[model samples]
Target: MNRREFVRWSGLGMMSLLLSGCGILGTSAGAAGEEVQKNSVSGGNKMKIVVINSSPHARDESTSIYLSDRFSAGAVSAGHQVFTFDGANEETHPCRGCDICHMNGPCVFSDAIENKLMPELLSADMIVLVTPLYYYGMSAQLKTVIDRFYSRTGMLHGKKSMLIATAYDSADWTMTALSEHYATLVRYMDWVDVGQVLGIGCGSRSLVEKSSFGEQAYNIGANL
Candidate 1:
């Protein structure tokens, strides 16, 4: 059975607004405006999808972007809404391990995750995390935002989710930590696991451009 054994489908910046594909981009228009990311694709059914891109590299050199672009392109083509955020570029700080949020209020800080992503994430039907594997785990940038999920964490439950990760090493264990972390998140949050596209051995941008990883990403998006 394929990861897409079932079908259903599903950014960041000023939430680089809009999912563009099949000629009908919703036009979130990268308010912060960086280019080369076209994850939108051709399909049907409308879902509000949020993409968190956590690669700190330049768009041209980031293998993670190479895969995320194709995945989202297929999604946009399939008629879902996409909001993308570059967590790495945004001014988001690490969690303070505070429990004020547990007191039924918002977080202590008004940083990027709070100011920008929280609303979109709260209402989003699905969430797609795009990142480059870092030290056997997810990028610290992405983790900081997730840790802030301490605030209103329960509101994020019961949504669909996916992960797209790129790594240079092709070892059998290359993605284990990240994969397990993602698995633990969905299980704990009661989220539906849409699927994951782990681009193993995808080190350089040039290599990723020619790899089937991009195609796999596109297929996942198209199906969703």
Candidate 2:
């Protein structure tokens, strides 16, 4: 089947069923995912959304996850199929400068990149990046994961993309670089622009929880 057709079929609940079974989440995230599955809306203009979250903190402690939880709940309530890629918990390493993937079939690293990440990315209709600003940029682990996309650049084209970011530096300038980076990736992938929730001043879990950014995130998903 064609990509559009496949995504349409996925909206029929096949992909929703796989969301919880994919083993991409830690225990806490996994339990929450079960709720998303249970509340899924059936037979509409649904989508397969892959959330790439790159936070080093544990599932319980991470502010990034907090925002993602809000976004996922909103998306599920709107009937989209959401699958989160817990980048920190997996074994995805930085792309070694082997330069082999360009001339070879795939990269040498065969852990999460091969086993989990690429599969979902290939099938996803939308890609959401949930990240904490690290020195005004994406986290190191997330950068590494993106680097590994070298092998499948062609396959990843033409998807929709969104960003959910948080930073302790409340200055508006803090998100400038990260936003530019995300814009660059969107251009590179030829992705349709979706809304973003850039949570400025969300320095900690409690801060993110208390922030209206969560509601912004929810509205993004709900309106979609």
Candidate 3:
């Protein structure tokens, strides 16, 4: 199936099942299952993770997209109940800064995040954002979503979050812009930091494929 079709269907499925399971199967069943398997517990303290991939490139083989996919696979292997969203798709509309979310309780765009993402967040124990560097910062697409997340206010409070970025520059300071950006959110929501992966020297997909750090990044995802 096409990427658009896949995300559209996945969003719909997530919404339907997330709501249904609340009454019939009980909330946190999926998250609980992961906890039992990963933590050696039966019913307590499960962690739900929602990973958002913020690369605007369309191809499945883009550096950031592949990294995000690998991370998702690793998260599943680590026994975490994970949900993934491709921020590259246009289905996720840019936040217009209209402040409609203040009264609407979600982004006024209402396509990907409002209907699908909020439920995942409500059900998740943690969040992971994976993106590529765009002008020394997160891709413009991701910045938009991050801004929209402001509407969530205290909803994500106390939850764990991590940032993963792949860039062409090897300098540590290359990620400073995103670090500053996420720092504000961390301060705003009072979230705990699980980890952050800054993969440098990776502007092209070939570079990402050739880089040794890609494997390390994948391991980070698998272990987290």
Candidate 4:
């Protein structure tokens, strides 16, 4: 079926937010001192976006954080509200796949999601995951959060989402695995896929700062 038909059959409430391209939703103002815009699809358009920076590296070195900052700034510039959580600073433990969360609710670990992340997520119109590559795959830090997401019991369904990833090399390969992981959730949650920002060919912090890719990231934010 076509996209619209698929959305209609999904049984999700009237596609609340854009639900793609970073998966931010709702009608909220951007960051302070920013302008809001009318939605092209609907007359009313304000986005409440929550950003999760899942990079294991420091926020300064996190390409995911850096790129997301650009997008967040862009959202603000366009009059959208953005909230962010850095997994690096969060104290979540790894998922044991014990299926306890599946039986219960939320994860058993102590981390930002249980405290800060969930509160923001429940109120957010959209959700964005910013992560780095580890061995050509998602960082373990981000994966831990994803595992915890199952505890939501389909709460994330129909929510908007975006994934931003940075890798030193062969990053494209990681996208398949990442997409597969998200696809499973999207199928059950009725979430939509927006766009992704992939930054490849940069490893060191210095390289990222001086690289044009950084400027591209900034532009991405400026336009978001």
Candidate 5:
């Protein structure tokens, strides 16, 4: 579906879900019943997806933000629960190579990773990493999160992964290194590589606003 149509549909779906517990769905049992019905219809538990958006820009104009939003919309529409993290805004401590986490214990830092992200990572069925390309590689903020994953060793194994990268350069080569790195990381974690979406030539917010990358991102999430 096109971006506009997807957005409209998603909005309507969200409204329906939100109102399902408010007597709008003609159910007296409230939201709890709605959830059970949904799970029953699906015949299994809904997938839990964690999306880590590592773009430094806090505004919606960033290409990474746009793609991540679209992906989240699609995933929610597909009955999956999505937890998103703004890596740049989060209080994540850099991995100090203290080798403390390697001892099968938590990292020494008492930051967001230990208090919040580790639980999400361990419970997620799928993980999506969204970042802006920096010097033909993932952003340092995102790299920090990846590095911190060392603390979890086997916690993330066998999960599904997707990468969405945006770059200012028009050439596809600009994202090659980042893509390879993501692939290697997925392999090392024993996670399946679901897909990768690269947004190129997005030097200006206007270019990204006018591109089909958002629709592609939505489709990726929908199909996942």
Candidate 6:
């Protein structure tokens, strides 16, 4: 099917599953027919994961990128299909406050969301947002994508989500505001908040590489 058709059908399928009381969005079955705990990756079922890497650096020079890579590695090791999107590089347009999406179907804009993100998002079992802290908040690039999500309101409920935030400051409050915003988003979307990994005191790429945050991120991915 074409991308748009795929997205439409996927949304419909998700709604059907939800109404029928199936637990595909979060639960899985263990080998012995036991129920796998939510957010646990022990079962052999392969999850569809979408990683939104919002760091501006193209290389592994940023802590956010480094940690996200580690998470992706762990998820891959557990046999999950992971798709990473470079938010900084995507040509995403800001939402124009028009309610065209509500009147029609998804967003009316012919941008990355229509051509790319929406399809993957509709089909993803989990979403990982990786961002470098900017002014005690998420990057504008990532925020733009979040704003565009308005087009798919009521279509993304129950999806699991995780967050990874990196910052140079070592203070306890380094990412407090951003974490609050992330929590608000999770609540608004009615998605599960799997976890959040904070990589603090990462002044340089080498420091992040040497920090325990990488291992923590990897664990989160593996346990997803």
**Alpha carbon lDDT of each predicted model:** 0.73, 0.73, 0.64, 0.62, 0.73, 0.74
lDDT, model 4: 0.62
TM-score ranking, best first: 6, 1, 5, 2, 3, 4
Per lDDT, what order, best first?
Answer: 6, 2, 1, 5, 3, 4
Q: Which stretches of candidate 6 lie over 4 Å from their true place?
A: 1-44
lDDT tens readout by residue for model 3, 1-224:
23243234334333333332221111121433444444321123336888888876765567877766666665666666888877767477666767665523666676877787777886788778888988887887777666666556446565667777889888868888887776555544556555566778888888887876566555555555
Candidate with top TM-score is 6
**Candidate 2: where is the Cα deviation over 4 Å?**
1-44, 103-105
Model 5, 141-209: lDDT tens per residue? 999988887677556666777888888898748888998787667655666666777899876678887
Candidate 1: regions farther than 4 A off: 1-44
For candidate 5, the per-residue lDDT at 185 reads: 70
- Give each model a TM-score: 0.79, 0.78, 0.73, 0.72, 0.78, 0.81
**lDDT of candidate model 2 versus the reference:** 0.73
TM for candidate 2 is 0.78
lDDT of 1 by residue, 5-61 (tens): 111111111111121112223333221111222432222347889999999998788
lDDT of 6 by residue, 31-147 (tens): 122354242533447789999888888655878989889889877876788988888887788888776776234776888766788789888988888899999999998988887
Candidate 4: segments with Cα more than 4 A from true spot:
1-44, 96-107, 170-174, 210-212, 215-224
Q: Give candidate 4's root-mean-square deviation (CA, Å).
A: 6.8
Please list the residue runs of candidate 3 whose C-alpha ends up more than 4 Å from where it truly belongs after superposition.
1-46
What tens-digit string does per-residue lDDT give for candidate 4 at 24-44? 333223322223223321123
Q: Candidate 1: lDDT over CA atoms?
A: 0.73
